[model samples]
Target chain A: MQNDTPELPIFPLILSHAMRPLPLWPLSAGLSRLAGHILHRHPGINNRIDYYQDHVFLLDITDLPLFLTLEPRKARLRAFRRSAVVPGHDAGISGPLAAFLAMLHGQEDGDTLFFSGALAIDGDTAAVLALRNALDDAELDLAAELAELLPPIAGLLRAGLPGMQHLTGLCLQRGSAASERAW
Target chain B: MELVCPAGTPAALRAAVDAGAHSVYCGFADATNARNFPGLNFSRAELEAAIDHAHARGAKVLVAINTFPTAGEEAIWHAALADAARLGADAIILADPGLLAHAAERHPGLRLHLSVQAAAANPDAINLYARHFGIRRVVLPRVLSVEEIAAINREIDIETEVFVFGGLCVMAEGRCALSSYATGQSPNMNGVCSPPDHVAYTSEGDDTVARLGGFAIHRTPRGAPAPYPTLCKGCFVSGERQGHVFEDAVSLDASRLIPALARAGVSALKIEGRQRSRAYVAQIVSAFRAVTDALAAGREPPALALARLAEGQAATTGAYAKRWR
Candidate 1:
């Protein structure tokens, strides 16, 4: 019989649409594809942020003043011991992970916040808390623009909402916070 | 079944004992304890008294030297173990492979119970620890199902203690990076997750922004109660989602599952949150004591008497129900 199936979409477009159904998806490939898109757009962040080994992001804590690494697939983290140059894409926080990062800068400026549940965390539960303390040496307030991301970029995230919700549910549900309003 | 309760200070040990804790766990006020907060935990002098106090009550004191020691500073951990033994602790809760090995050799008769930080999720790993380091009791990770727990119980000769109430750790210990990327220090070494000092909430226009370690974890209405910007529970913008990708802000309460856990043959019930008040600890210990007592007597737990103690006034059975991926 003659083949009549639709050919696979172009690699670039396919890469553009790649998404992990799991909430904590690996940032390596997704971030690489994101790098591809960023290279298509601004390109400078790729120069500032290195990305080679399994999606590592080095935050320019000196220039922008925050060093952060996120592993979406696993709900844990590894905090750098000191402020130094490391060869990895440092994910500079201009978004959600920002305020708590400021708390790591060492001021009791944060609010009456709740934890997801006493039990649920992504990667290393202890490491997550330690990383927060490591950043607790200074007071923080990210650049205003980075605090609330611009609408155009926000649209990109909103477009991928369902997949994000499903993945987050996978990551946190059995978590104490799963009983919270949104879960 | 045993009741493993928290004792942040020497005095808390007395309270936990007076409140009827079967065994109490406390940590050094340094990086050694998972509750490595300032002004919490016991000093060497305090430990001597606390151990003495628990001993007087005929209860056991399990020193929690659980956080992974710094790569080269294993000596700090070793000294803590020596001190615990010197002061007469009933057992030590350990997580690190090297430390467990060290304790097994250095303090052979100290009675070791593996910490949840060890993340022993299966029989093979549990057996490895048991065989390698002579671990007598294993605190199973929060990832196992009751059926899994029962199955592990059947195979392992040692006792198994699963976390029954208080905070739940959905992810394995020593594996996450969400906080470190934002701040620099994290739990595996620092013994905290989303440390309170790194948490901030700011008002911008109509939205409230919650940040942890310089990362904005959530954005809610200005007056709404913002959950702590814990990386896992915080809201984020990913692909098409703009909500908590890991979990929302809530605390774990597993009272309803006590009967199931008892059937699974668990040796003890662990309560999280050592930084909580003595009143909080006493309340939870008493409540669980009642539940376990009733479970021991083959009766049902009393109606929800400890509901208000949880963060966000919510609770879960966690993975003991076994639905997590």
Candidate 2:
């Protein structure tokens, strides 16, 4: 069978390399500030945060090698990049970049990923449940927020966002066809 | 015949009970049950409350610990049964023979309902379970026709339950390894089939494709609804027929056959969506309750007002009719 491996563009590879050396603290601080403002808009979330008092969550995007420690106890939520001292988090959820994004945006159900072994969670499950419930109730639009953060790439991101699903579908179709032909 | 409804959470259990379900079935929040999805099932505290609530309202609560146990981990399934008995479950639904034997020996007073996951299609298998483990009820596999079911009923003294509505599994229950082949996790061991984490949907050009474990299972035009890519109900190439080879992305809607099923000596009718929301649970349970009520009244069953609730906007009687065979 002819090799049908979908070649990934070099951009993400370059970006991933460049992101490794860059200081993530500033970005994490900025995002946490934004989360504070957003949390105030959803009182239900503010109340749910109290249930997770002092509980910190490590959200690891395993595919991208990036991690964020989320503190959800205070009036405003805070996101911090992983540091050596951030070892004993109350809970940690790790998944592929796409599955995490899909779950965050409510496009995909969390149970689907967990059931499919796409996502892994460790530590306090109750803390994870509280955070999931709060986020679901708030319905935060991360895409819109990212667009606001990067105005020049806003249109490009919006265009690329819709294509993610299509691209995923295309890759699978091509891959399956290749495997079947090989058989 | 009784109406057995599914409940994912305590709220859904209440909704099912309020909607007139004669019995509400649910499972613990772990891999012990088939619908072991996130944010579903009941914690111990919640199950106690739910059972209390259902019992007070004249509805029985059946605890489903139906998934087959993994090798070297039979104790987990046993512990679940012990907890169910301690919690006053009206009956325990089970699929594993070893677990059934343990339940029979350990908790003799607890009622046993053989899970559909057991795939007990014929009278011999059904009777074996009834006789050896004292299983009082058996949920028949979906592969059998009504006539086959009637024949089985004539031969087996145990009560039988049948799925009347909700999602359809093309493969025989307890016998499907497709999900495991694709995702390394299966309904039998992990209690999840077509797990969402392994599913990916992407758009390419003007079409959207649904993939499971890197295999394309379905493709739809942009703006068209893409069904969940369960392996059996997927579009595939077979010779020259490149369409749904096994079954379409339609749900089981046997609401029209309640009378026939009742006549076939089916002891209960089951609705099959524990992953659904409380509103969905209430609506479906209420609709099925109406059908059973109409049959009891000696009147024609009401028209099914549940097309909107079915998967992919379509429903079929599945293998219940001979032509589907």
Candidate 3:
């Protein structure tokens, strides 16, 4: 089988990274500030990606001009135009997603692309698919840029929790398993 | 006051019908049905026989074509609706808007019961279904409490059905993909979730771990009785927390809440397992039958009797309590 080994899913990878209660994972508000910083440093890669953990990001164009956030909570990248910052865990994001957004920020028009099948979208499929056609035109390899930009956050998390990269390191070591009643 | 129950096979159908179910619901053996599990549902011949058996016993039969129709390929679903209408079934449970439109136009008199998949929680959504497709009753999503159901009943003209037993999905019906994310198959698309075919129970040393799509959900001692790894009930590590983050190994049994549900204006009560054996079906249906009958006669209700059936799995009133919100 040519595509035999399913590419290690980036959706779960980023989610596992963001699963921390630490103040490092950038939320929506923090993402806006990060976006502003990127716009200043790498003006070429601004507002061309939308991030979601629902199923997958339905990027209609490889290079779009908006970053939509759909995980942990429902928020969008363009939301920063008004408030620019939000309270709570809005700013904390895993290093992987931050790297991906930075890649999409510098895309050109008419770039249609599809992510791997079933990207862990926790929301409605049709609603997200309906919004798929609205994508900005740009060209940047999200998967590649993520690797380059993730080193700092990775070091920080690894330092806080020793040997945190492997599967065994992510063991549920504390807290109520999950408030079963909260379901 | 009819009690519609799920039957995954002819034997279960007979069990439900024999157990004094006012009505029973099942599906054709294909993707057209929601409980499209392996070794479940009925063939065309089996469906006819099931309907014949139910009708002879004075119990009704409903055929469910509840999963959403795939884009650009709705012919399969449309034909299922037609075949169901032709088979003289009591009613057809439908969810997709396009499919409902198709059925309403083609089989105009074919009765339509809104599947819980429609998620018509609010009056506006319910009214939309009623006005456009003339939907008669809606199997309300498990997300609502009894008080909310009464409030909804007050505002809508349609009858309502509430789940009283079996598997529980924590998310709003039809608005989730946790299973499909881990395993490629999904309830809304392929009609199965965390599909049993993809599940593997492996012995890793002294521990037994339940794996769905190769991800570990829970690991217990090898001697422990491990449950199937359903996504909602699966254990996950989030920050420092681990355990059943979404739910536990419990199935829902709101048998205790039937009276409250009755008072809340629910016209019918539904049991969720279409995949159980004949004897299990008989026991549960019989118990609930007596409960509803007593409630109808204005007599004091009997104490609950399905504790052994609930087994080690805990039972909850589920979203009937708003703590889930």
Per-model CA lDDT versus the true structure: 0.60, 0.72, 0.61
Go through the candidates in order and give the C-alpha RMSD of each one to the true structure.
18.8, 13.1, 21.2
What would the per-residue lDDT of candidate 2 be over residues B219-263, giving only the tens digit for each residue? 776544445468888899999889888777777899998899999
Q: CAPRI verdict on model 2?
A: incorrect
RMSD in angstroms between candidate 3 and the native structure over all alpha carbons: 21.2
lDDT tens per residue, model 2, A117-154: 45556666556655664554344566565666668988
TM-score of each: 0.63, 0.68, 0.62
For TM-score, the strongest prediction is 2
Order of quality (lDDT): 2, 3, 1
Question: Lowest lDDT 10-mer window, candidate 1 chain A?
Answer: A1-10
Clashing pairs in 2: A112-B197, A165-B202, A165-B203, A166-B202, A166-B203, A166-B204, A167-B203, A169-B202
How would you encode candidate 3's per-residue C-alpha lDDT over A100-167 as one tens digit per residue?
A: 33223321000011111111121233233212211111122222233235666654553554353244
Where does model 1 sit among the CAPRI classes? incorrect
Comparing 2 with 3 on TM-score, the higher-scoring candidate is 2
Query: What digit string (tens of lDDT, one per residue) describes model 1 on residues B1-325?
Result: 8989987645346556767899999988677887876445667877887777778778999999998888889889999999999989899999999999999998888899998888888889999999999999999888788898999999989999978776656677656677777767767776666675565555578775767777887776643444544687777899997875786555567778877787888888888767554445656777888887887787877855444456544456777774743
Q: Candidate 2 regions off by >4 Å?
A: A1-183
TM-score of chain B of each: 0.93, 0.96, 0.95
Could you arrange the candidates by TM-score from highest to lowest?
2, 1, 3
lDDT of 1 by residue, A104-177 (tens): 22211211122221111222222333323222211122221222334566555546644743543211111121
Q: Residue by residue across B1-325, what tens digits does model 3's lDDT show? A: 6788878767567768877899999998677887775445677877888888889889999999999887877888988898888888889999999999998898999889999988789888998999999899999988889999999999999999999887777786755677777877766755546564566555578865667777888776643434435777777898999878887766678887888998899999998777554445666788889988999899877867553344223567888975752
